[model samples]
Target chain A: MVDDEELTPLHPNHVKVLRVVTALATLPFVIVALVLEVRAFLFPGAFMVPVVLAALYVVLRIPLRRYHARGYQMGEDRLRVVKGLLFRSDTVVPFGRVQHIDVDQGPLERAYGLATLTVHTAGTHNASVTLPGLANETAMEMREAIRAHIRRDTM
Target chain B: MDSTAPTPQRTNPLGMIALAAQGLGKSALPLVAAMFGLRDEFSGIALVLVALAGVGGIMAVLAFLRWHRLTYVVGAEDIRVESGIISRAARSVPYERIQDVSLEQTLLPRLLGLVEVRFETGAGGKDELKLAYLTAEEGARLREVIRERREEEAVAGVAQEAGAEQDSPPIFAMGPGRLLRFGLFEFSLAAVAVMGGLAQQFDFILPFDIWDWEHWMELVAGPGDWIAHLGPWAQALGIMLALASLAVLGFATGIIRTFTREWGFRLDRTPKGFRRQRGLFTRTDVVMPAHRVQAVQVGTRFLRRRFGWHSLKFVSLAQDAGKASHVVAPFAKLAEIDPIIRAAGFEPESDTLDWHRAAPEYRTDSMVLVGGFFVLLALGLGIFVNPLLGFAPVALGMALVLGEQVSWQFLLHATDARQLYSRRGWLVPKSTIASRVKLHSAEISQGPLAQRRGYATLLLGLAGGTLALRGLPVERARALRAAVVESMTGTDFSELR
Candidate 1:
């Protein structure tokens, strides 16, 4: 069970696109800040270019490191997750508690051979985790394993 | 078969007429009010109002027709209601699927000697069925007939269980005193309704009212003497006013809640499930299988905390809508809960040792980041534009956010079996639940800032919904996740160290 590699690395391009989308979301805020800075320059006042740059750097760097380090291991008993930038974390989801599973991909993910897995549990709405940016074939295989576990455990 | 026995037969035509009137009020009141407000417009406004009145009258006629059209034929396995005028629809509710049966008698129905029966199904609001305008006696007899059938099933179940372990009976009956006590004590809904009514009458914050300072002062001070001058009388008046308001509010609320929740209230044991009945104007009957209870929550509010009363709520799929199938027993001091727990077929007491409190990781960080951002905006405005805006407002807002953040605390407990209990809340605390079977997914999330703080959040998904626990100790959250996954698949699992 420990040796079973249910999760395979996601496509690098998919990981890149995810980070790009995140950075693009912050673009409007950056534009607003830049406009404010230009206004401040004309008026000889305080500007926030340094803060904006620092935020952009942090946003791109974290996901890059996380994608590089991220991996998942599936056993008959639990679904294990290994992910983190500096502080690593491993999450396990057992078959008995998993209410259902969702496999999803956005247009970007589809272009890059990546998919995400979402699991649900009963007591806490937040029990399940989504392992985004998984290789498409690996995500399909993992989905099958989770489904098989659900059928056997439910009986 | 009970078919040979004589059955009472009577219907309330007047009550049926009233139901039609109520149905019309629901559909036509807005139209009537709109036309009334436009009465001064082109003489066509009068024609509009007349048209609306005619429509409302037609609705009343239709409602009565529908009421007369409804007919229920109870079979050994199910009860079917065949009604609906143009597109005739039939609702066939199997006995097993019924969550509860309520016999409700509104003020009008009570006067007319009629009761409205409501059949609450396991699913959402759309599944519920209603049969109105039956005589009260007929309603009671029908309820008894259902109860007797359930009892026979219970006896059969007990005999089977007795063959195995000689266990006690599965059902417990509440005494009349207990019912009355439950009715008197559960009154939060009533308190809220009264507060809403008072807020509407005195809209002090309305810009128009704020401008009418003289009118407010006159109303407050009355004709001559200022309000403060009547010292002792003022104090007495204040006390009496508060009590009178609460009493009227409580009475109105208690009666309504009791009518819906305790009307024809019955607790029955059956071979397949447990049943509860309650309602006033429209009774709701409910049932749920014992094995399907995913989680149990025993909750007490500030009011009930003093009296040690608890309301037991079940996380069951069958009855997932409205109030679900809950037992609100007042005076449920620790001793009373044991039987209720047993009745639920689950051990009442938690098995795990009270582990260390799991503090939320993002509590301080989130409050500081979000509060700091807002404070920065305010400070920027103050520095660049208006010094009059002052640091005091921002300071107060930051303090409030920090105060709330500091109070967030989570406790995690695990049973010898796969059961895990996680409860966290501040101000109005709530219990976080996860059963072994309901966990569909879990993820440990962190961004640039959260990673630095050595924290992550776990997102859990349940049958009806999802919740995200943010700013949790990453290591502990990981360990908890592993335990949940292990229990779920029945495999030996280790923490993600």
Candidate 2:
């Protein structure tokens, strides 16, 4: 049932880079808040600095942990992905229906030895499974395995 | 590879000129209209600019003869088109994968004795894959070549044989009478504006022409003036005149529509499948075969329902040409639809309704939610506006929500041919049918509300259209999915492939 050892682990910094980039991309919101804080200081009791800071910090914290850190298993019959926190989701996409698999890497991800694997199915909904924070080699392997399984089942 | 393959690769250059004109014509009228409202100082400059543009346009037209370079080749395998200037584009479409081939001829093309050819393929999208402006004769030859190639593929057992031609599908030939009907149907919108403008411009159509405008104002100010101030006889006469004028205007609009749209409409069944040829100034021929089709939809608006009329269209896998994929059946009786369906190799649904056996513990949560929306609307109105108006909306919302739930009459049934059918469409009704072999996937989803109500929605993925059964008994959704999987895996419909 399990052949776990042969499966390659993703690069260690992959998740960290994703989290940091996501947090940094949202730096504009932080800057805006700081500007608003300055405005509130000049005109006291007018702006809610603490509330805005708390909300931004909370939003940043969630992505910082969740964005880069995730694990996936592309089984013969189903694709398993465990993701999210507070409202965690575990999805099982059966192999019979999956149409194709795509592996994509952005410039930032390239620096982190990571690739995003997306599994596409036929329908309008989330057609396939997406497993981020995967090593390039592992992504290719998973893609081939998933492709073989889908083709076998559909054919 | 064929020893007898034709060597002459002929295409109509005249048609190319016509194509350019058609593209130019779309923006021409607006450009001409824009010329009217320029400032005095700019008017002289605009005229000079227009003159320069005219000269440049003439020169461009001359250059077009040299620049409009296209080569079309009829090979044994497929049709190939090579066109473009600096960056050349060459596209070849296999006969087997072609959804349809259409011929279009605009006013210029008609005058120039040319026709534009359009090919619809498996990869349908917004952009057409193949287009060439060819002489009318060349267009006909291309059509023949493609049709013959498709036939050959069928004969060679590479493609599915077209089902036997059924009764000819109902054709809505736009005569003057039908045009009048179409015009009347759209009278409130375009027709009214046209009539209002004409009456305002001319003084002869109405008895008092300008007085009609005064009457219109008076009627708007107080409709009572039309009935009470005017004598009963005069009021009656005025009402009759208005009705007559509306009819005449409707007829005129219909004539325009008929001329512009279905000037020379024709639908016929060929050996390959169904063909629709239309257009007055620009003729278009579209062809759809039996096997390539995904789903069939029969629909009617409230106005059309009284005539026992229905429109037919097919859902195809092709992504391009959303409108082309939707073939419009101008007018068809409910009884005479089998022929159209059979021609496309799909068995029509049984006249008797196939009631759904939803899961045992189905919930009315969606219905409740719909009702809740009405309640919220009422509450909002009560808070923001008149309390009495709130009740009216609440009552109306309840009626509407209740009607929606009742109208969601979904049924999932299996055909003797091993095809699964799910028909669900309430307001604008549609039926989604799929062969088990063509079933790509099935999804069963339950939202928080749906879960509480023991209800779920099942989406059946097929080649043609997506079949969705909402608020189904969750168990039933699963069962249906399992059944589809079983049928698909148990027996192969690869023979159709």
Q: Largest TM-score belongs to which candidate?
A: 2
Q: Which candidate number has the best DockQ? A: 1
Give interface RMSD, per candidate: 6.8, 6.4
Which of the CAPRI classes, incorrect, acceptable, medium or high, describes model 1?
Answer: acceptable
* DockQ (Cα-based) for each candidate: 0.26, 0.17
Model 2: per-residue Cα lDDT over A1-155, one tens digit each:
22232333356666576567766766676677677867776555334566556656755566556654345555546665656543333344556656677899988878888888987755444556577788888888887876766545244
lDDT of 1 by residue, A48-141 (tens): 6565776678677766776778777766556767677655555566655566788998888888778888875544444556788778887888
CA-lDDT, candidates in order: 0.61, 0.62
* DockQ versus reference, model 1: 0.26
Tens-digit lDDT track of model 1 for B394-417: 877777686756555443444345
Candidate 2 DockQ category? incorrect
Candidate 1 deviant stretches above 4 angstroms: A1-7, A19-63, A77-92, A95-105, A116-131, A149-155, B1-19, B30-57, B64-123, B127-266, B318-331, B350-354, B359-414, B422-476, B491-497
